[model samples]
Target chain A: EADIYQTPRYLVIGTGKKITLECSQTMGHDKMYWYQQDPGMELHLIHYSYGVNSTEKGDLSSESTVSRIRTEHFPLTLESARPSHTSQYLCASSAMDRNTEAFFGQGTRLTVV
Target chain B: AQSVAQPEDQVNVAEGNPLTVKCTYSVSGNPYLFWYVQYPNRGLQFLLKYITGDNLVKGSYGFEAEFNKSQTSFHLKKPSALVSDSALYFCAVRAKAAGNKLTFGGGTRVLVKP
Candidate 1:
């Protein structure tokens, strides 16, 4: 089935650790996005990519960086993870049309102590 | 800027009762609206959308939403609530010309009580 996938569904690490959250889609979508969500809070868009090698910061400023090396892969990296980085990270991909529905990956929950 | 709003922080409904999740939008032009549901520890799932041509849109899991242009709203509704329906619901909007960048609401947590 064509789906978006995220690796390491759950992660826990000490502060000052570097980590990468993997996100890949098999849907051949042109738009990819990363959102952060704390329990019981609204999702905040942190990054998005329109296509390969194109990345942009989203509404909420984030300390992480994302790269779109390929159409199917948009991975996010945090140089130094902190307790504040503990949240659920959601990955989504959509077609080029504004009205089209986007597909989402299961999500990665990262915890930094 | 195009945006959607879910004013309620949470809503409580008894099982087998009707349920509503309110959503409103603000856009410069005709709006493309959508509703998504997220269960605990899960990614968002597309529920329904309102693009054009129709006022009522049906979606997965026996849920539906009505688009009201005059009110600038697209509220999610279900005929009967199930405990499984307890989840976070979000309303999203995109400008007609703005391609594929969705602005989402704060989200509403729907609780279906027994």
Candidate 2:
């Protein structure tokens, strides 16, 4: 089984609340990524980090920010959640090598009311 | 920029029948392709990847993919799909020189009937 875990499997909150989604992997992977996906839809890459202190925005623009202070932990924070920001957030990790496939967490589904 | 495409939005097949999902990608230089499966409200699970070597790569759950470098395609297939295999499948691509970010295609929903 994949060791990656995302906390708060489901979250429902008010529009203006601040929220942080936690992602951690026991696999000690160097590359971590956060993707936004609607149910049964395409996945849009929002944020990814090559290693500690290295984060880059993905193909799609996103309002949330991510920090990779630790190799095993990559957290995404939304300053002020809005209804538009509600979606399924997936966290994945992969080794430094390009040949390896990424492992995903169970995902965090957020709903802003 | 690297991108992937899944032509079919949905594919239906009877149980114990052959299954195929089409995928095509574009990338500068060589490409690293991958296939992932998602079951309902869950995160994507890695199915398989084609980095190099053989054109046919086998992965989890009796799934396999064929990489056609000339056509820039990696299509997933199963000899006999089961009802439990029904799910959403995604195709992704990463270029060798494009860092480690993966570009995913629009998913394809697969339905297997018993």
Candidate number with greatest TM-score? 2
lDDT of 2 by residue, A12-98 (tens): 999999999999999989999999997658899999999999999988899999999999999999999999998999999999888
List TM-scores for all candidates, in order: 0.96, 0.98
Model 2: how far residue B5 lies from native, Å: 0.4
Candidate 2 lDDT tens digits, B1-114: 788999999999999999999999989988889999999878899999999899999999999999998888999999999999999999998877677578899999999999
lDDT of each: 0.91, 0.94
Interface RMSD of each: 1.3, 1.0
Clashing pairs in 2: none
Instruction: Identify the leading candidate in terms of lDDT.
Output: 2
lDDT by residue for model 1 over A38-93, one digit each (tens)? 67768888999999999999989999999998999999999999998999999999
Name the top DockQ candidate.
2
Displacement of residue B15 (Cα, Å) in model 1 is 1.0
